[model samples]
Target: CLGKEVGADIPFCVYQKVARVRGIGDIVEPFKLKVGYDVLLIKPKQGVDTKIAFEILDLDKCPHPDINQVKKALINNEPLKDILGNSLLYSAEKLVPEILDIIKECKERGYEDVVMTGSGSTVFVLLEKGQDCRDLIKFMEGKYPFVYRTSILIK
Candidate 1:
């Protein structure tokens, strides 16, 4: 069970909802953050080992955004770019080359706020309301075998 052993963000991934997961992945506080967006999830051919990725991360160099500020951003419907500006995705990039490539491609395709999700080989791009994400999805599908157009499961 690497849930609590590996990292605190594991359980939050399982729920796929708005939450403030605390206490080393044991405590989950679900909250409502009224926001609307679509996500294009891209999983590249290469696999990234979480253990090795963790080994390479300099914990001191990661950006730790305040939970309250995140909540405020979500509730207030801040631009996706603004909300993800302080994400730790930058630190995790070097360990996952495939994910980084996808991020770069997404940016080139005019997508904003492309981020690697939770020790990932999978990266997601946020599409604001009314944006035509079909072209992005199609492009990713053509490039990668596993691409999903999904939404945040806010409950």
Candidate 2:
């Protein structure tokens, strides 16, 4: 309940499992999702205001991914690229150039579906099964102070 007032993503983060958030961030439905890979979280030097990001989001320039499709892909264990190709906060990249830079860098390094997590700054790239991200991490070592190899919490 506290998470709702703090941020929409917080509730989902607290659940730490596959979930479908509905009804203006009040409803959270947890479910089983067969996820096969971990995520690389890269935090840039800059940060963004969640309120400002939402306020300035341009639907035309930054498109929101279809939530149903994302849920279906996760449940079906689809290709990592297909399952995580889009981001709800992608449009916020326009407001924060650093976010866009990180996305571009991740793509150039063969990382797919690189998106800013939650509101800003922190970006995550999905790593496929058996794929090693050491090189990518090394590449980002000096550039970004916070880079973590992490997986979603399954409940």
Candidate 3:
């Protein structure tokens, strides 16, 4: 959903609850602290450029640390601005609102923890317990078109 329009696909590793191993429809084992759901492992495409996965994102076109923009830029698949001279971002304050809005929306939707990953344009939320991330993806299928290439994010 989130990557459908962007061409990026969100490959998740789902684990169905072990307790409900005998059910046709999905069921929740609230008492189980670590209930497993169906699992789906998604690996990114190969040959992709180095991303902010575990690297620094130099986007302010300078030197500093605006982790948010770095994350956003990565999500947008924008080139990482090398921090050669100085300055981390050109106008981070101006762009922060957009990131905040994304985070806010996730919260409104009931995500317990939403964080901007590395110095990339991607914003992720680790939910406590509620709706499927797929539903959220379906909801955000349009807003970001550049994220589709994420399949190759760490390639």
lDDT of candidates 1 onward, in order: 0.73, 0.74, 0.36
Q: RMSD to native for every prediction?
A: 3.2, 2.4, 16.0
lDDT of 1 by residue, 1-155 (tens): 46656667777676777887776676877778676767788998866676777777676877766667767777777765645643445545666567778888999988877877766778888776557888888888888989988776657
Would you list the clashing residue pairs of candidate 1? none
User: In lDDT terms, how accurate is model 3?
Assistant: 0.36
Best candidate, TM-score-wise? 2
Error of 2 at 33 (Å): 1.8
Instruction: Identify the superior model by TM-score, candidate 1 or candidate 3.
Output: 1
In candidate 3, how many Å is residue 154 off? 18
Cα deviation of 57, candidate 3, in Å: 13
Candidate 2 vs. true structure, TM-score: 0.82
| Per-prediction TM-score | 0.78, 0.82, 0.33
User: Model 2: C-alpha RMSD to truth?
Assistant: 2.4
Error of 1 at 24 (Å): 3.8
Better of 1 and 2 by lDDT: 2
lDDT of 2 by residue, 31-126 (tens): 786756688999877787767776766668655567778778777877545545344466556666777778889899888767777666789887
